[model samples]
Target: MPRTALFVEIPGVLIAAWAPDLLLPNVGIALRRLRQRNVPVIAVTDHPPVEADEFPDFTERLQRAILEVGGELAGVYAALPDKPASWRKPRPGMLLAAARELEIDLPTSWLVGTDNADAHAAAQAGLAGVVLVEGVDPPTEELGIVVATARDLCDAPRVMIPRQGGCWHDHPQR
Candidate 1:
């Protein structure tokens, strides 16, 4: 089975991990690209059991860590959900809600996550693209196009949002 990976901009840092100790090799490239573009990145995560204000600090720290880890960030939303709703992975609620709140174009935005839940959520919301990383089961060929492997998501071709009007692809198409 395919390895399970987690590609998430969490409250503590921009992280990408594969099951059983796998990690993204090209994470540096992705971070550099994100910084170069100056795009706003938010971590739409399952709310921690901590106080509300604590997340802001966590978000800031995570942003710093992403930079330390070679990630660029314009900002972070770090929104929390009360239950398993659209804001959670596989539902597209979190991505869609974040995009709307951030005033970003859905098609221009990309969701890089490890599980099929993330891909499903990205697709459900009609985002520009979704990249599934290691750990998730191999899609039965019913999901949208596979943009890249976990190690090469940032270096792969970027999906552009024509309706919004901008070039997002910084590398060759996969």
Candidate 2:
């Protein structure tokens, strides 16, 4: 079973989940909420591309996993190429490419992941911002930005706000 962490919604005020696996507990309500709001939803990841047949099986499995957990599947964006500069985390290239291909405005989009790389990518790609999930931390002193968890992001203030707060090392909690 997968674990879910809720994240902030974009322009449509929807809800999203971030998990290593697709199935999650208590995600049904959130998925239904997003559906009720008619928001565009998707899953973003750094997985490399697979062959056509394999990709379908993977997508089907993912969809089934979501449904099995009582969650809805708006869509998923995977199959990123293996080039670091083009598809790696912290680059924003793969995400930007996906946004363009999907016709989603980068500014109104949210990137949910479990690392500073994803956060940096969101910042670089003009996303509303990133919702950093639990269990990953990059040195805050080195990286100027630090996001806590998915739930923290959902309740974050509206509008694009810069991180002018204390550095990661400055906080005792970190």
Q: Which candidate is the best by TM-score?
A: 1
Model 1 residue 129 lDDT? 59
Per-model lDDT: 0.51, 0.48
Error of 2 at 55 (Å): 3.5
Candidate 1 ranges beyond 4 A from true positions: 1-13, 16-29, 47-54, 68-70, 77-84, 144-148, 152-174
Per-residue alpha-carbon lDDT of model 2 for 65-171, expressed as tens digits?
65654455556655334345555666777666666555655554555566676778776776645555454554364333334454332332222243544321122
Compute the lDDT of residue 49 as modeled in candidate 1. 29
Say what the RMSD of model 2 is: 10.1
Model 1, residue 6: C-alpha shift (Å): 15
Model 1 earns a TM-score of 0.63
Task: Identify the leading candidate in terms of lDDT.
Answer: 1
